[model samples]
Target: MSTVLIVQFIALAVSVLSFGVALWLYTWVKSQPSKNSRVETIAELIRRGANTFLRREYVVLAKFAGVAAILILLFIPHPIWTGGALDNILMAVAYLVGTAFSALAGKVGIQVATIANKKTAVAAQQGIKPAFLAGFRGGAVMGMAVVGSSLLGVTLLFMLTQDATTLLGFSFGASSLALFAKAGGGIFTKTADISADLTGKVELGIPEDDPRNPAVIADNVGDNVGDVAGMGADLFDSNVASMAAALVMAMSLDNGTPGKNVLTVFLYAALGLLASILGVGTAKMGRGGSPTRALNSSTYVTTAVYAAITALATWQLNLEWRIWGAAVIGLLVGTIIGLATDYFTDDTKPPVRHVAKASQSGPAFTILSGVSYGFLSVLPAMVGIAVASFASYLITAPLGAGYAMFGIAMSAVGMLSIVGMIISNDAYGPIVDNGRGLVEMCDLGDTALEITDSLDSAGNTVKAVTKGFAIAAAGLTVIALLGAFIAEVNEAIVTRGLNIELLTGFDIMQPDVFFGLLVGAAIPAVFSAMLILGVDRNAQRMVTEIHRQFKEIPGLKEGKAGVTPEYDKCIDIATTGSLKELLPAGALAIISTLVVGFVGGVHAIGGFLTGNIVSGLLLALFMSNSGGLWDNSKKYVESGHNGGRGSDAHKSAVVGDTVGDPFKDTAGPSINTQITVVSLISSLMASLFLTFSLF
Candidate 1:
């Protein structure tokens, strides 16, 4: 075993152990009897009532899960598990089957739990069974179905892309970029939803730290454990697995010998898994009361990994200065992007009376700081891409280094906070609105719910979604330009022995072709927006139906009928907030499509758009759903803490006082893997497509 492999194994084992310990402590705490930490005064009671709730199961389950994961790690055998075209095909098939089964199983379990919770809660309230209790089961089942279908779709996509590139003469470069672009769009959409849920809905109705707030408990568990830990596992399992598989394939092609650098793949896999855990853990630990702590840890972990990997790759691969150069360039690019965002971002603070104070150079300094930070963020990603692409060139057989570079470049862009923020916003949207609706229902003594400050989260989600679209636009544009250049070179090389007339009509910018590419670019956003609208509408309808049914209950007859204006407004804000954003997003997409198509050709643009959409959607769905799960779990805990009974006055008073669950859901889930996946998947697809297209 290589030294690197040994180190990786050790790290993975430690991660598992640490996760186990954390879970054990959490469960231990929960198993104990509830302690009444005194409410010192009336204010204290009000505060304590809201802030004390936390799901005790997270720690317990996490520990067991962690330990289990470690044990599972041992099963990953030595030697390259996947090599050659046949091996990749089989690996893709396995991933597809595994993800499908997992999704189905998870969905069923969730539904059963939801059903049980609703049924038991209602049965205690009334002598008769509650209809909504059954609704929980249906919803859970439906959720799982959605997840399964989505995963199946993605897995199939990966299969097709790989097959097309290797077996069929499809360009790896084209397919990969298209997937990433699509995934980017989806990630942005889902992230925006999450943000809306946290800031607008959750913050307005219930604070993250409020133990009495069911929303609080839900956010804690749903966003923290589900999003952070679950995502950690999922991302590591899927993306890292795919990457490792791809790396093995690429290296085999380059080396012309299957055995060369076999240990590197294993080592990287271990590192990737560990990194995944830390990436998620940092975010989870930051929520409720420790935002900065979680964020800082995440930053540190990512930085350390990036630095270590770059150093090792450079030394082992004998890539000379390219490694450091790539890292530096990445950092610089990231910083520039950050600076631009900071500068362009309009000051959201209310108009101040002191114009001089407002005009202070603080904005400029902030821009500079953001730029510098952006550079830091960009370096790791850039270096990763650089190493992967450049290393391909040194091998006797080329594995399409150019396409690898393209993917890496896109991945680097994903590291930026702008991408992270956009993702966070989408994931939080639904949760926030749900909280607001719940609070409003309680306050008005009506079936109708009212909510204020509920649109903030929605707006944030929209903002993030828009920003992500813009980023995708930019990424697609770059890929297209690069692809066009590659095509030109390929045409020259391939045409040497053939009659030039056979390839003479190869116009890169066919109008009909370009049009299709443009359409594809816009498709992901449209699909995501429609999905969000559909899901939210369904949720609203269900909640409304539940409210109506509650009115039929004898004791619940105190509430009035119909939806309130506030609730209506909240819905409008959440649904339509991104509409205007769509216009700009569309424009950017169009511009990117045109630029790339014009420069490279219709095929390149199409590939770029396709890859982006696929990757974006996958990332978005992962973050949004996972975060929602976390939010729900946290709510369950808070519900139990609030004397296992609903309390409105207490939930409302402290709801406005708490900062949202930004750390666990947004900074953690939305920011890290969701964003990273967009780039990673795209790059892998691009490289694979390049090889296929060449043949």
Candidate 2:
């Protein structure tokens, strides 16, 4: 076998090993004790609700995938009539595989997280250390499963098809599922969260996670579906996109000979997974260790491990040093972005505390302060992205004029090399968030409450960090995808024997490019608005439902012994609304891409991707940070600052949190997937756009 094939097998081995680790972690989390009947009952409810939402979502998405498959078979790469039926068949099958893998990764996360949340709540009665371990280990399952599956899928697909373009079809499939998983799950989570807080906290002054609140269970369910499943899908897409883009470029650079570059991509990706496995294995906390510190420490360990091992491999395997530098640059910048997010979102940090202080003046001041700090927070991340992308490009430009973009793609790969750990940390957030709720509702002693609160708080900060990290990675991945798009367009041009000059890059001096840029920038805003509005409309309905339950269900509001609010009703509303609203926003993003591509051709798409990247990054950063700021500010108040819970300031902060719920959880995070989806769409449709466009 060629060296490339050997490296491919090695990458495959690493992926399988990661899956083994995931299985072990899942077993470990499952074995953790869960003794509280109340916690078990409620946990089962959350579990059931989450599964219901995911099942319905998949059923709908299956229809979508089917239609997409037909389209792929008929038109993608070449018209079926053009006598490329074999390639078209491969593309369709790969696309289906991509969607299936992404969905399975998400399902794995939900299954483990549901079990972990219950165990974490029960374990909290013992102490924070055990609970932290339970949550982290559970989340590690998702982390391992996602990165493992992406690597495995990419490796097997390439080995089987030996075609780089086929990977784009697979990526588009992953994006299709992710767009819904993120947006749909976000809408569901925020709908329940906002309603719970509004009816329970603001109006009736019930404690957070109070069982009497009808929306409370739905809120917990949202944590699993949105944060666990949605986030897992989002990261899965990013991982796959980064690899697909890199491979597309790598194959071109390698030119079918013994190829070091492709080997480097697979090996680095495999090693990154290896590093995450090590990091997760060592993840632990002392009895009184700060959960935030433990999580951050494990992340740092993973980063260090990846860097050291990749460097050694570069030397031993004769991989290009410049590419290594680019990858490491991406990794370091990702770490820096996470720290910047932590500063903005951590309650101990001034931005969050300042927002909390502003809440004393009422909700408006809270909003103003959070928004200000949020905008400021974007500076560091933007600078980090700029520095990483430019530095990687410059580092690799020495190799050849054509190598710079590939270098950037490598950087994204490097940055996400530890995504297994990132996903673990992220999934841990909602698991512990559910744990915090369970403890409160079960009346676990104040001791357990304090432990869970600390874990949940850490989860929130880490989640903000991971969100920043994920968005930054998406920004890098899309830049790489842009490169991949140009590569695809040029290949298509060659194959079609186009009379026109081949595309090197987009020139914004052209009118079509400018038009696409303007339109592209607007899409993020429009997409964000649609998802947020979905939450708003859905939340209003849920709030009304909540009020109706309290008014009609005797003793529900009073917490009467035998009277429980109908949590199923709230879950059903969130499910129905999320399914309804998700498609329109996703459709808008996608349909607009098709419109722009058909209208302006490849030049417009180049500009379109550019504008979408710039504004999408900005809005995603601002909304995510500001939402985190508001959320932590409320937590800061509840932690006995600003007159503690139920005070006027606390109430105002609750309102701020409500406003932020959708911003961070729904629209903000979803933009990453939106950008990726459009980028992949542009790549997949490159040939059609070139051949058919009016421009």
Candidate 3:
């Protein structure tokens, strides 16, 4: 067998091993103690509500995917009547497989997370160590499943078809699922979160996660859908897109050795997965250790391991050393970006404290301070992405024609090499967050609540860091995808017997390109606004339902025995409203990309994608960091830094957190998927645009 086949088989083996580890972690989490009846009851309610939302969400997504598949069959890459039917069929099948694998990863995450919440709550009664382990392990299941499935799917699909275009179809499938999963799940989560906070904390003066709040169950369920399932799909999309983009560029390289670039990507990705598995295995906190420290340490360990292994592989395989350096550059920049995000969002940092101090004056000051910090926070990440892309391109430009772009793709892979660990840390936030809520609702002692609170706080900090990292990775991946788009367009022009010389890159001097650039820059802003507004509208409806329950349900506020507020009603409302609101926002993104492509052809689409990446990365970092800063500020205030809970400062901080919720959760993360979807769509439809356009 060729060395390429050997490397592919090795990647497949590692993927299978990762999946096995996920299964083992799931069983281990299940084995943890969960004997409390009240905890069981509440956990079951959260589980059922989460599952119900997912079921309905998937049904709607199925219809969307169906229509999208039909279109792909008819028009993508080529017209069906042009004797490209088999390839189109393969592309459609690959697309469906992408959606199915992404959905399955999310489903697995939700199942394990719901079970782990109850386990973590029960373990919290023992001490912080066990509770931390339960939450971290539960989240690890998602981390492993996502990375494993993404790697396995990409490798297997490529092995079967050996076609980079088909891989683009698979990546598009993942992007489509991510769009709905992230947006729909975001709306569902924030709607429940805002309604629960508004009525339960602001109006009633009750504590958070109070049993009397009708929306409390929905709130817990939202954590699973939004943070666990939604985030899993987001990262899955990024991971798949990174691999597909790299493979596409590698296929176009004029290197003397065939398959060298392809094998290098596979080897790097496989090594990264191996590194993450080792990091997850070794992650542990000693007695009384800080959860934050433990999480950060594990991330550092993964980065180190990935660097060492990939360096060794580069030496052994005789690959381009500059490309390896580019990957390291990406990894280091990712770490730097994460640290910058932590500085803005961590409670131990000045940004959160500054926001908390500003809250003493009023909500306006809180908003002003948080927004300013949010904007400032964008600088580091933006610089990091720009530096990584530029440095990688420079590092590999001397090698050959297309190697520079391939190096940038490698950098994205390097940055996301430890995504398995990042997902674990990110998912841990929601699991422990749910643990805190469960501890309160089940009436666990103050000791248990305190322990879970600390764990949850660490989860939040790590989550902020991971969100920054994920966005940066996606930004780099889409940049790589843009390169792939150019290559695809050139290849189509050649295959169709056109006499035109193959184009190398987009020219900013073109009028149509400039026009598309201007319009594309506005897309992220409008898309974000639509999502945030949907949250606003849906939250109002759920808040009204909460008010009605309090007024109509006799003795619910008084905690009358045997009288429960209608929790199911609130869950249903969030479910219905989220699905309703997500469609238009998704449609807007898809339709806009098509309109630009049809109007101005590939050059315009090129300009459009560049504008989208620039603005999308800016808004995503700003929103995510600002929202996290506000959240940590609220927590800092509640911890007695600026007067304890219920103080004027606390109230003001709550308002900031409320505003930041949708910014971080719904709109910020969803933009990453929107950019990827547009890039892939442009690549897949390059032929049509190249052959026929008004401009």
Candidate 4:
């Protein structure tokens, strides 16, 4: 068999292995004991609420995906009447499959996470080791599923179709789903989180996760939907988009055949997944090991293993060292970005400590300090992305024409190479956050509280780092997509027999390119505002509901034995409000890309993607880091650093964290998906844009 065929089989084998591991992890987590009747009942309520939100979200997403698939069938890659009917049919099916796979992975995360939260809390009574193992292993299920399905789906689709254009259809489908899932989930989460914090912690000075607070259950449910499911979908979309972009370019450079370059891409991606699986397997906490240290160490192991294995593979396969170097640069930069983000967001770091100190004065200083540190935190990640792109280009440009761009694509693939590990780390955050809440409200014990609290703090810090890592990867991924757009446009130019000059690159001096550039820059800001505003609007309603519950229900606030806050009511408010607000913001991102493509054609799109990526990366990093900083600062105060819980400093820190709720969780992470969606949409619609633009 040819190397490509061998690699394809190997990829499939690796994918299957990941699924096996995920199954084992699931079974293992389910076996963990949680016999507390109260914990069980509350966990059931959380699980039900989370599943309800996901079911409703999927119902709405199904309609969107349905409409999108039909459109892809009719127009994408070509019009139906122009032939390639088989390709169109497969594209639509593949698109739907992509959505289904992404949705399934997310559903799996919710299922395991809800169960694991109870297990982790109960196990914490045994000590941090068992609790940590339960939480980490539960998250690893999602990590494995996401990367495994992405690898399998891409492999099978490519093996069957042998058309890169079809992969774009699949990617666009993933992106479309991810965009809405992230937005809607973010809205749902922030609404409940902000309401619970303000009403319970700030207004009434009640403990967080207090059963007397109606929004507490909704808040816990949001952790699953928004953080676990939504973030899983987001990373899933990024991994697929990066691969699709690289494969599209790899095919052209290989003269549309399964050449050495093509084999290299498959091999590298497969190896990356294998490394993450090992990393997850080897993750262990010491008797009193810092959860942050344990999590960071696993990521380091994954990174080292990927680098070592890829290097050996390159030598054995006789692949170009230049390309391997480019990939490694991307990998190294990704690690640096994560570490830098940890610095800005981690509680042990000066930035977070300073932010906590600022809260000593009041909430105003808290906001100002967080915003400043957030903006400052953007520099390292941005610089890292730029360096990765430029260095990868420089190292591989000598290989041949188009190789430079492929190098950047490979860089993206390499940067996200350990995404299985990244997602494990990322998902660990929310699961443990939920564990902390469950432990607190279930009255598990003060020991359980201490363990989950430390784990939750680590989760918050690591989630921010991973968000930065993801956005940086998207930065390179979208740039590669821009290059793919050019490849598609030129291919279309040849097929249509048009006498136009094929685009090499967009010139910003042209008015059309500059117009798209300016418009694209504004889109992320507008998108962020809409999402944050959605949270603002929904939180107000939920807050009013929270107020009504406390005011109307007898002795609910006083923690009377028979009094229970109506948790289901707040859940309904979040579920209903989120679904209503999800579509508009995502529609704007996709629609703007279409408008730019039609109004100014391919050149405009090239510039538009550029502008959108730059703006989106900066905004995403700032919001994620700053929000994380504020969150950790609050934890710091609550830990009795600046001041103990219920102090003026604690209240001010709570305000800071509250303002940051939508910033990091809602808009920041979603923008990464938003930009990827725009890039994929542009590539899918490139032929139409080439043929029909008035300009």
Candidate 5:
């Protein structure tokens, strides 16, 4: 084998082995440690104590420094063992640096949080509106730190390996800085979004007359700054999904030469940022009552970008053996786990008032409403994943055979992972919070409370479903990484034997036949749209039922002032129209992916897929936050604008929030945390797969 390929294989092996050992150790420690017997079993106790110690800040720094030193020692060129030590050392350094960078970035994140707190104080004092990005300035700071560290680390690694250290170091340094800045920014952005969700959804409550509402302001600061900015950081800085694109780009480079800019770093970053913004806007679609189920815009855009990038790298740039088929399989398995979890946990049962307010249309409406509601709540996310995956293939037609298929598989995994988490969180949070809100009211009798209590239990199940998704994501990420490694190894063996026909089933052409491709692309959108409409219709039925119940209750009369039918109708209209608005996002994804694919060739599919998945995840998170902020803002604004405190308007704000538990923070940040972990797994898994082929 050539020296470079030999090095690549060695590096890949080391990464996979090291990661496996670390993961196994972590899991074993977690499962075996006794909570109550903290001081027992000398060896086991020592191991537990050691792990705890390692997690400490100073200890972590020392470990990182030690790993760095080891890399420097081991990366030296040698003839021993076929000159493979250099490759293994290089791979080790990559992991060590990545780990160190992540740790340092976290410290920076803490500092950013402090700054946000200070800013919030200043804003409160100055009577300025609180903006999400003021807090997100911390994320920017973290991004800058990560970028700086990554650049320095990569430059040093390169310097250690090359003969013309001075010249190569300078060029590599500059290029690494540019790439790291963008990549680190994307990471920090996702972290920031998670942090914000942690604070906004869990730590804080909806305030009276909050200015963050979307309806009152033409340019809501939260949506523009908090949601968009945070998402941008996540996609650019933290996302592993982008790694596949990066690998494809690197593979296209001329013999690993340091000269040309192989990657379209700027363009990809822009697309990633766009995905984040789109994600924020589309988050509301996940809500059961909102219009449109086909999938969020983020997924469409991200998948397209990933595909386009891969296609360009392969067909136009002539890159080869860049796709990870096993990773795709692992992802599929994980998605199935997530979907099963969501299916059983989802609650579509009628509320207590359903019987009292039953429509003359009878049980048929009830069943339809239940089915519609369930479909609406879940279908958009699923469909979005499917569409994003299929569209990625169309965008990679020119990348020869295997690459396009791999892109689709990766996209499918990425999008599904994201959607599963969002649905899980949203479904769980509302019900729990709604119940908590009722408890806090102290107005309901034991009987009414009991009914709501049942609703709350159902909500917990929803939360469990989300947890199941998280479990699946973590499992799949590991599996995908392993799968990708195995596939690469197998492919290498086949190539060494000069065998071309040993590749597995269902290559790139399966999803690309005229009707098949169209169907694949359209199905998600169509299903999602149908689901959204169904949810809306179901919600209207419930609202009408609730209204009738109130009217019929002899002793439980409506107050002199309550939301009028017209007001309820307006809410229905807003939600129903949202789906139609969401359609444009999917359109953009499809159009953009196809256009980019046609021009760039099939390998560009990697780029489009990466972009779409990143976008979808970001969008899902953003939309949820934005929608919540808007809901809260509207409540506060209406209360203040209609009249001062104690007015019916004010009361409504209190009651609406209290009853709905819209933000779902009443219990804790668990739901937001759930989504955050999901995001983290996506990034980690992407990295694993992308790096596994070549370390």
Candidate 6:
């Protein structure tokens, strides 16, 4: 066998090992003690609500996926009458495989997270060590499942078809699922979150996660659905797109000698997963140790391990040092972006304190300060992405034609190489967030509540950083996919014997290109608006329901025994409302891309993607950071920094946080998937656009 095949097998083996470790972790979490009946009852309610939402969401998604599959069969890559029927079928199947794997990964996350919340809550009664372990390991299961499945799916598809275009099909499938999963999950989470806060804290003056609140259980369920499952699907989409984009560029390079580049991408990704597994295995906190420190330490360790292993591989395999340099640049920039995000969102930082101080005046000041800092926060991440792309291109330009673009693709792979660990950390946030709520509901004592609160606080801090990292990786991935689009369009032109010259690049001076650019820039804004509006409408409905229950259900607000508020009703409303609102936003994104491609040809589409990425990144960064700032500010005020809980400053901070809930959780992160979907749509339809576009 060739060296490439050997390396490919090794990557596959590593993927299998990741699954094994995830299983072990899952079982270990399950084995943890959970003897309290009240804890078990609350946990079961959360589990049931989460599963019901997922089942309903998947049912809706199935219909959407089926329609997409048929459309792919009919028109993608080529029409059926062009004698490409077999290829179309294979592509459709690949797409289905992608969606199935992504959905499965999310299911696994939800399952383990629900179990871990109870375990962590129970363990906290003992101490921080066992509680921290339960939350971290539970999250690791999700991380391993997501990265492992993405790797295994990519490798298996390539091995079967040996076609980069088919891999694009699989990626589109993942993007499709992510579009709905992220949007729907985001809306569900924020809707529940906002309603819970509005009714419980603002109106009733009750503490968070209070059993008197109808929406509290729904809020906990939302943590799993939105953060754990939704985030897992989002990263899965990004990871698959990165590999698909890289393979497409690599296959078009070195006079068709794509083996070396393919092997290099696979090897780098596999090593990253291995590094994450080791990092997860070693993650631990001593008695009274900081959860934030433990989480950050594990991330640093993973980065170091990935760098060491990939450097050794580059040296031994005689790969281009320039490509390796590009990858390193990406990895370094990703870390820098994370640190920058942490500065803006961390409560210990000045940004959070500043926001908290501003809250003393009013909610308006809180919003103003947070928004200003949020805009400032966008600069570093945007610059980092630009630097990584430009530096990678320059470094590899001397090698040969097309290598520069391939280098950019490699940078994306390198940046996302440790996505396994990123997902683990991201998932860790929601698991512990749920644990904190469970502690309150179970009445596990003030000490246990405090311990879980600390863990949850760390989870929130780390979540902000990981969101920045994930968004940056997606930005870089889509930049690489733009190159793949050019390659795909050119190949279609050549195969069809078209008279048009190959597109070297989009010229900014062209009218069609500029038009597409303006339109594309508006898309992320419009998409975000639609989602936020959905949350607004949904939250209003749920809030009304909460009020009705409080007024109608006697003894509920008086803390009378045997009179629980209607939790399931709020969960149902969130589920149904999210499903309803998510479809239109996702449809708008896909439809607009198709409209642009068909309107001005591929040139217009190129400009469209460029605008989408720029505006999307800006909005995503602004909203995510500002939202995190508001949240941490509220936490800071509650910590007695500004007037303590129930003070005027705390009330103002709550208002700011409520407004930010949908901004950060619902619309911001979903933009990452939206851009990826448009990019894949452009690539998948390149052939049709080449032949059929009017302009």
Largest lDDT belongs to which candidate?
2
Candidate 2's residue-wise lDDT over 175-215, tens digit each?
88999999999999999999999988999998989999999
Worst 10 residues of 6 by lDDT: 250-259
Give me candidate 5's TM-score against the actual structure. 0.36
Candidate 3 similarity to native, TM-score: 0.99
Worst 10 residues of 1 by lDDT: 349-358
Q: Please give the CA lDDT of all the candidate structures.
A: 0.31, 0.94, 0.93, 0.93, 0.31, 0.93
Q: RMSD in angstroms, candidate 4?
A: 0.8
Deviating ranges (above 4 Å) for candidate 5: 1-83, 130-133, 143-241, 244-261, 265-267, 270-378, 402-487, 494-501, 505-695
How many pairs of residues collide in model 6? 0
Poorest stretch of ten by lDDT in candidate 5:
213-222
Candidate 3 stretches with Cα past 4 Å from truth are 254-258
lDDT of 1 by residue, 1-695 (tens): 75534543454464354345334423332232212222112113222221221112223223433442332222211112333444444433433343333333223322222222222222222211121212112222222222222223323343344321221111121222222222222322233334333343343443333222212222222322232223323322232223333333333333433232333333333343334334433333311222223323443454456446645765775543432443333433433432332222212211111111211233333223323332333333333333433432233123344434323332322232122222222222332232233233233222212111212222232332333333332333233223333333343335345342322122426654455445544544443444344334433443343344334444322323532222222223322332222233323333454344445443454455444444443333333322322223223223343222223322321221121222222322232222222233323333233223422
- Per-residue alpha-carbon lDDT of model 5 for 1-695, expressed as tens digits? 54333333333343334234323423322233122221122113212221222233225334434643463335322222545565445544544444445444334333333223223222222222221212222223333333333333433444355321121112221222222222222222222222222222222332211122111111111121112222222221223322332332333232345322223222222222332223323333221221112122323443344444434534553333233222233234434544443343332322212211221233343233323333343343344344544555555435665445445434434433233123312222322222222222323344433333333333343343433333233222222222232243333345346443432322334322232234323422332333233333433443343345345544322233322222223222322332223233223333444343344322233333333333333333222322222233223323244443444333433333222221222111112222222222222222122223221
Q: Supply the TM-score for candidate 1.
A: 0.43
Residue pairs with colliding backbones in model 2 are none
Model 1: lDDT equals 0.31
Please give, for residues 410-474, the per-residue lDDT of candidate 6 as tens digits: 99999999999999999999999999899998899999998998898899889999999999999
- Cα lDDT for residue 74, candidate 3: 91
Model 1: how far residue 116 lies from native, Å: 19
Q: Residues 94-208, candidate 3, lDDT per residue (tens digit)?
A: 9999999889878988999999999999999999999999999999999999999999999999999888779999999999999899999999999999898878777777888
